[model samples]
Target: MRPYNFSAGPAVLPESVLRTAQQDMLDYNGTGFSVMEMSHRSDMFHSILYHAEQDLRQLLAIPSNYKVLFLQGGASAHFTQIALNFANGFKRIDSVVTGNWSGIAHSQMGKLSDVKVHLAAHGGDLYHYNDLPPASQWDISPDSAFVHYVINETVHGLQYRDIPQLGKDAPPVICDMSSEILSRRINVADFGVIYAGAQKNVGPSGATIVIIREDLLGRCSERVPNVWNYQKHIEKDGMYNTPATYPIYMAGLVFRWLQTQGGVAQMEKINTLKAQTLYDAIDGSGGFYRNPIQPQARSYMNVIFTTGDKTLDERFIEQAAVRGLMFLRGYPVLGGMRASIYNAMPLAGVEALVAFMAGFQRRYG
Candidate 1:
């Protein structure tokens, strides 16, 4: 049996998706060409892209006003591209720093000479990001271009349970949902732009999915390159340049798998059960295992916990790997444990991890 993977990104994929990819590796749809070798402009690849978008739309119930673009450069590249695209005329962009990714995005936006990066809200101190500041406390600038926030902070294991209700007059909300996009249901119209790297929940590392309102398409800065511009991508149907064909195709398969499993609503139910099971293990460990994030903001995707001893933590990771529960180590910046239970992670995988955690705690507690 394959080991359960809990790595953050380039992470676990559904086993069925893997099997399908394996079967089609050398000859996709009897074309005698691997998807990796197929031309992005080919009719076969176009069908792959078309079905991927349509299935995703159907799964999310995405509004007609939104344009879904499959682009490359990962979510990091879009950090700069987002500023260039939407922050063109405005002098300031509001960013809420809840974890490492958002902090990086805020810093990247600050590198731009024209716009100011406003600190809208933060989880906690620089060293410990254990709690989310309520949206009511966010000091949003009224004249800012848009409000950018991460729906789920992968490293810190913090999540916003509900969408932030910024008043009607507030600027558009742009979100980076790299870790938890399709795992839950979100209204597409709630935000001006929603972008996620495909690695975590979608499929693989190369493709980045951007769902943007049609009106926001016209805001791309003239200085931005055609490849990085959203409007240019939308014009070509997300093919302004050669796209990440293999990853997109893989993502297409995952989308179909989601539909067969009864779609995002069903996935959310399973994901909730998995998260609650793991969190229950940690919380019920009698202080042997501890997760510092507040209960309300704890993530349903990434669950972070530590045994409070570095030696014990290392030993736990080592033994978990030996037992076929892999990648239980936390992010380097925050040293402990993080089990990223993305959509592809089955409940059985989570239950195995929980069993391992209980065994480790009993041995060392």
Candidate 2:
């Protein structure tokens, strides 16, 4: 049996996708060439890339006004790219500092360019994730090209629950949907840019999907490097640099699989149930286990909780691993145990996790 994998990113992929890749590893489409070995410019690879983009557009209901680009450098690169590529000579951009990812992203943008961030929750000591910082307090300017927020925070298991309707005058919104890309439906037209590191819910590492409004592509400062420029990326079809072909291909496969499963809306329903199962188990455990996030902001993908005792937390992780549940540990910044139930993690996996947690609590409570 394949052990249940619960690592945060480079996370679990659908078994169906994996098996298909393995079968096609040596020969792809009877072309006598492996997908990894095919030239990116070749029609074969072009077809692969084209289909992937189409499937993603269909899966997300991406508007025709958006340009989907498969690019390199993961989400980290986009952190810098967003500032340099979209700020249009404006020194500062808007940020909503929510959790670890958002913190790192906003901090980078601030250092590299003139960036302004309104901290949404400072470590969220009160309710794990209380309501986000009220929108009125943030400094907003029309010249500030865009606002940014991470849709789902992997480490803290916190989410916005709903996209913040920044004030009417607020700049366009940008989101890092790395950990929760396809787990729920999103209105693509509502945001200026949506980028995701295709590791968690999409496929493997190395690929990042960037969707930017068509008109917003050329607004970057002229000082921006060609490689990071949104205009260049869109013009070259995300091929301005050698792309992460395999990761993009796998992402395409995953998109197709998601479509087969009835796309984002259906996945959202399944994800809701999975998160509820695990959260309910923890909630009903009489304080044996606890999630820190506010109920309203709790993440549907990353479900993080604390055991209250350090030693006990260690015990639970070690014990959980022994039982074939792996990578339950949380991010280093936020310690405890975290269960990242991304798109590929089925309800069965969550059920197993919940049952084991209940059994462990009974013994250790």
Candidate 3:
């Protein structure tokens, strides 16, 4: 039996996608070879990548003007790539610091150029996430590379419900939608660049998916290495270096599975229902438990809440783990429990988690 996996990521994949891959593992489409053993340049592999990119573009409704490249860097590598592409002629960037990941992004860019790490509105816990910096306070530059924000901060269980419209005063908007990409519907046209590491929401960890506006790629600073540059990957059709063939293949399968599930819009509806079930349980669990973000900014992907008593929280996780609820613990940077309900987590999975939480709360409330 599969346990309800709430791992932040490298998390859960749809069983159907996995099953299909398993079926095709040994003999891919009667080609007499495993997909794993196929050459990346083979016609079969080309078809896989071609369809994967097609599915992704359809899922996100990405425009033809944007280039979608499946690169090798994790989001961490993107920390430098973003700065590399934009900071060549530009000197500064505007970023919002919500949690550790964004904080690291802010700091990493600091090494390359003058990154103006704008202070954001952060409340103490999950209940206070909506406190955002006023639009008026956003330091904007007409020529600044881009403004970065995580639509969903996986660690803090914080989400920006609406993209902050900085009017025409700010630089182009760039987003890291790693943990929540396909879980909900996003206006792809709203962003200048959108990137995600495939592990969490896509399929596996090693591959990073970058969607960039075509015109922005060639402007990188001369100091930027060719391999790390977005234009290089774009020009090479993301095969510049040896790609993660297996993960990319799995991602393609998963993308096809997503198409069967009615794409991102349909998935968004199911996700909303799943998140609400879990959040409602936490909210109604009484003063015994507390969430850290404000109501409006609560993340549908990662639900972070704390049991007032640390010892009891530990016990709750321990008991839940034995019951087959796994990876419900918080990140080391944040000392609390987090339930990451990504796209793969079905409505039943969230329901199971809520049932477990209620039973746990009843015993220890």
What does each candidate score in C-alpha RMSD? 1.3, 1.8, 2.2
Question: TM-score of the candidate numbered 2?
Answer: 0.95
> Candidate 3, residues 44-127: lDDT per residue as tens digits?
888888888999999988999999988887988888788878666676677776776777787787575555544343333322
Model 1, 238-276: lDDT tens digits are 888999999999999999999999899999999999999
Please list the residue runs of candidate 2 whose C-alpha ends up more than 4 Å from where it truly belongs after superposition: 114-131, 134-137
Alpha-carbon TM-score of each model against the true structure: 0.98, 0.95, 0.94
| Steric clash count of candidate 1 | 0
lDDT winner between candidates 2 and 3: 2
lDDT of 2 by residue, 1-365 (tens): 77789999889999999999998898989998788998898889899999999999998899999999998889988888887778766656777776778888877875566655444444454334444554554556666768788878787777878776775667888999999888888888888899999999999999999998888876865677888788887778778888888888898889999999999999999999999899999899988898766788888898889898988999999999998899998888778999999989989999999999989888988
Deviation in Å, model 3, residue 141 alpha carbon: 2.0
Clash number for each model: 0, 2, 12
Task: Point to the candidate with the largest lDDT.
Answer: 1
- Ranking of all candidate structures by their TM-score, best first: 1, 2, 3
